[model samples]
Target chain A: MSKHLLTIIDYGMGNLHSVAKALEHVAPNFQVEITADKARIAAADHVILPGVGAIRDCMAEIRAQGVDTLVRDVLASGTPFLGICVGMQALMHSSDENGGVAGLNTFPGRVHCFPKDALDVHDLPMKVPHMGWNNVYQQAEHPLWQGIESGERFYFVHSYYVEPQPAYTIGTCHYGPEFAAMVGRDNLFATQFHPEKSHTAGLQLLKNFTDWNGRL
Target chain B: MPLAKRIIPCLDVDRGRVVKGVNFLNIRDAGDPVEVAKRYNEQGADEITMLDITATHEGRGTMIETVRAIAGQVFIPLTVGGGIRTVADIRAMLNAGADKIGINSAAISNPAFVREASERFGAQCIVVAIDAKRVDDHWEIFTHGGRKATGINAVEWAIRMQAYGAGELLLTSMDRDGAKSGFDLALTRAISDAVSIPVIASGGVGTLEHLAEGVNLGHADAVLAASIFHFGEFTIADAKRHMASRNIEMRR
Candidate 1:
């Protein structure tokens, strides 16, 4: 069996070292590298795109580094891929953050700031940025959640959400109303929550993604 | 749904590794903060607190390099405390990848620093750390590495700090610290009741049930401990399992 190579694409928005360090800690034997190189990304067995901060700055860095073409090529190869936070938003067609920005268009959807009306009265008094832990609702069953239980909470720190097609959403969380939290189609999977910060459940999710056979 | 209570593992970092003891004595090597942090991250710690116990007493700067090193590896929200006195220190730590900065002796000495920090960096970025010890049958605030008594009531101090713009209160019981009997429920409940902001109960957590009891009876928003977690006495997974079995709302 050949060893899996995991490459975390760094576009210089937020911290990439933390994501790389987490991957190394979890799967020490696997090859983990934080790279912006296009060829290395294209040649990896699995691709991970992790981002933080505003969508405008995130996309700007992606364009400046020419990571868009590299990421598109990796997905075209049909290898497994995972996107985290703004990385997941970048998979959609566009985002309403920073006066609306175009995304990679890997999936059919748009990311927008969560509507105020969808929030419950208890949460209405809460502040923006929605920083903390929230419960996630499983929209559909997928191999990535094989061992995880339903209604499991994940650490979230974002005001924007991805409005993807219902068919593509694997799980939803209610910060305001039912919003897409995790999305999967074929070998590609993305999450709006920070799985690395979600503790045991989050680690289990990452383990599931690493062990997935890409059958579904 | 009610806001879920948090289970936090605190790492007292000294010279790069984690250490723990009662009254801050007989320090034993815990483990690499990075490695232990990763384990807690995997075991379901709601948050991780890295307290640089030596930074302030030794008159050193905040451990930005150590924080950056840990931040590079752990994906959980990281809170770094000790030796943080100025807004620049907070900014440096946050820029180094800390999600929040904890202020202890500094805030107690100069109350206005809290308001200034919160004003410049937002309230959510500041965490006020209070160490309380019983004196004359009344809980009083202790400062300067738990050596000096401030003659301030714990509850009153908590309320005052919140009014000064502290987003969260990390209250520690100096009397019960590292005792492992359990959290000082009296102190926990008092501070939790006094403050509208989140209160993280610290000191004397031994068993899994202690955590649940702290939240249910003490009304603590989170529980922080060191000896139990540092000495391999209990893992976060085991703690959460016990909490869940008792029907305590925890992030599984």
Candidate 2:
């Protein structure tokens, strides 16, 4: 595991410890570093963008720290990269939150809020900030989906949902209707769900990330 | 995706050790905080809530180590409560690897604390734990771990907390705390209906069915328990299966 340096990009907005702790737990001896330094992020064998706060502040700090271009470079380097929650949302074109904020725009789409009138099959108000464990139905057979069965529940805590292009959407779930739960192409994978908070299914996903060779 | 009803296992720690009491009284030692949290995480708990019952008066600082150890191995969302009164305190907890910080007495003392903390850390990491009991005809809020009554109405306070940018509310019925009768459905519904943020129904979970009722009847977004999960009465997986069988949506 020492051969793999997994760098967790810290833009001063995420609950960083839990994600790093989980990754270390799954694969001990892996040199896991949590940093905002572009050199460290770019030099690591793998990169992860994880966040828990507002996307606006996240993007702001990412750009303020001059890591926005750094993130683009890491993705272009074709390393096995991942994003969680706001990290996944930050890759979009823009968000309607905080009275409209620009995103990194790596993927061509807008982050939209779940409809207020959204309801589940039971008519329960599909609450905003859909905070709880929900299923992540795999939309494709990618390396990140290895060993994990479809419809496995993963924890999520966010109000806004990303509307990435269908070509990039690798997973989908339903609150009112189907939305992108996960997006992946080539070596990159991002999840609206928090693999760190999720138990068994989540552990498998993290392990898969460690073993993934950035291949389809 | 539909928010799967959460099953949270709460550990009420008094002096660096997990303890269980009947309505915050007659304490009995449960187990190590780190090990118990790890077991719950492996059993598929949606989240882990650790309440330091004694930290409000003279911080012990032991729970920090407990949180560090638990977060290292648990690999799940850990929410820590008790003695979190200020922004600095919240930062310490988050730095100690707590996914979210739960504020009770401080929020009651100064409602603005929630707003300030939300502004500083965002609403996603802030949780307001409301300890309420039925007083007269309505549920009245309590502080100091259900010992002192604030005379504040439960539902109104929940609504206000949401307005204060509280991401979630952990509503515990003091009268039912440790009684394990079941969750106070009326009180839960009143609060959950008043606030759009997810409300975690705590206290009075004596049976497996009571857990399901917390979501189906009480409309609680999550059901939390200590005695049932800690005492080896039922596993979190068992509760999920039961809830799913009742046509209640859950992640099994």
Candidate 3:
């Protein structure tokens, strides 16, 4: 089997260590390197954008490292790309966090915070940052969902969620209201939940991504 | 389905090894932190909380190593608490691959530290650990592993912590710690209802039924216990089964 180089784009944000370790655990044949170098990322066999913290800081650092355009270029080139947490949110057109910030606009959507007065189905006031294991319902079939059931639970820890166009949304989860959980088209797959921290079901998703050949 | 109430297995680490004590006294060896954490992960634990019970500053290094070792293999949320006092401390733990940094005494000494840490590292990763002890009519915050009292009302402090940007609250009842008598339901409910952020009810979980009560009665977003899980009295699956039987949503 040919070796694959999986470059985890590190713009000085997010949990790169855990993500790299997870990828290494699942795909022994793939070489995982965490780097902010544009050349290394652009030349890799696969790319992952892992992010956390605020969108403003994420976008600022991403742009500072010149990864914003590199990510767009890489995704457009049909290179398999994955985004997690804020990395996924940064792909949207804008976010309603930190007084509103612009994103890469890779997908036509906006990221919005859970309503201040949001309430769970139990009529109890819902908490922000929806931090826990929640069911991720597959809205559309995709290669990443292979070997993973539709209603499998994944760990989620974020307050703002993406509102992507119907054409780009592949999965949905509910906290206060139904929101996009996984979004992608062709070779690009991004998730608001962290697959690296998610247990068995999450490892399966990463394995599927590693095995994917960037085909629909 | 809504978000399932989480079942977290906490491992109190003292100088690189896992230890447990009743009511925060008589500390006894449990096992390796990494091995214990991995075991819990395999048993379908929703999350793991590693409390660095090591009091010395040098012991912090070992805790970091433990966190790194666990994060490399265990694929679940890991929270590292105990003696996290500075922004540098928070950064070090997070860099060591901890998903969240649990701050206790620091939040009491310097309230602004919570704001500063949250602003620097985002609220999602900043967990304010409030140790509370019941005092007559109300609960008061305690520090130094339930040794020192801060004279701060637990409910009021929780509200303040939320205002200062705590993404989550790990509310532990000091009086109930390791008592195996179930949680302080009144204390848990008071803080859970006071804050909009998720609250993980910690301390005093002896049986599977107690875990369910933490959610059903305490109204906690998550339930945490150390001895019950570490001593092998109950597996995480058993807790989930009990919770599910009680009609509480669980990951399953």
Please report how far candidate 2 places residue B14 from its true position, in Å. 1.5
Where is the poorest 10-residue window by lDDT in model 3 chain B? B52-61
Q: Where does candidate 2 stray beyond 4 Å?
A: A120-124, B56-59
Give the alpha-carbon lDDT of every model: 0.79, 0.86, 0.91
Q: Work out the TM-score per prediction.
A: 0.68, 0.96, 0.97
**lDDT string, candidate 1, A25-104, tens digits:** 66766788788877778878778998876788788889899888877777768888999988999989999987889999
**What's the true lDDT of residue B130 in model 1?**
92
Candidate 1 stretches with Cα past 4 Å from truth are A1-5, A25-30, A68-79, A93-137, A141-143, A146-155, A198-204, A207-216, B1-4, B21-44, B56-80, B84-143, B146-199, B203-210, B217-220, B228-247
Scored by TM against the true chain B, the candidates give 0.95, 0.97, 0.98
What are the per-residue Cα lDDT tens digits for candidate 2 across A55-158?
78888888898878887788788999998999999988899988999998888878898887766544667666788777777777888888889888787888
The TM-score obtained by model 3 is: 0.97
- Model 3 ranges off by over 4 Å: A1-3
Best by lDDT: 3
- Per-residue CA lDDT of candidate 2, range B77-160, in tens? 889998888788888888889989999888988999999998788898899999998999999998766778889999889989
Judging by TM-score, tell me the better candidate of 1 and 3.
3
Error of 2 at A179 (Å): 1.5
Candidate 1 lDDT by residue in tens digits, B94-173: 76778778998888789999998865655556889999998877799998757898888888999998888787889998
**Candidate that would win on DockQ:** 3
In CAPRI terms, model 3 is classed as medium
Q: Please give the range of 10 consecutive residues that has the lowest summed lDDT in model 2 chain B.
A: B56-65
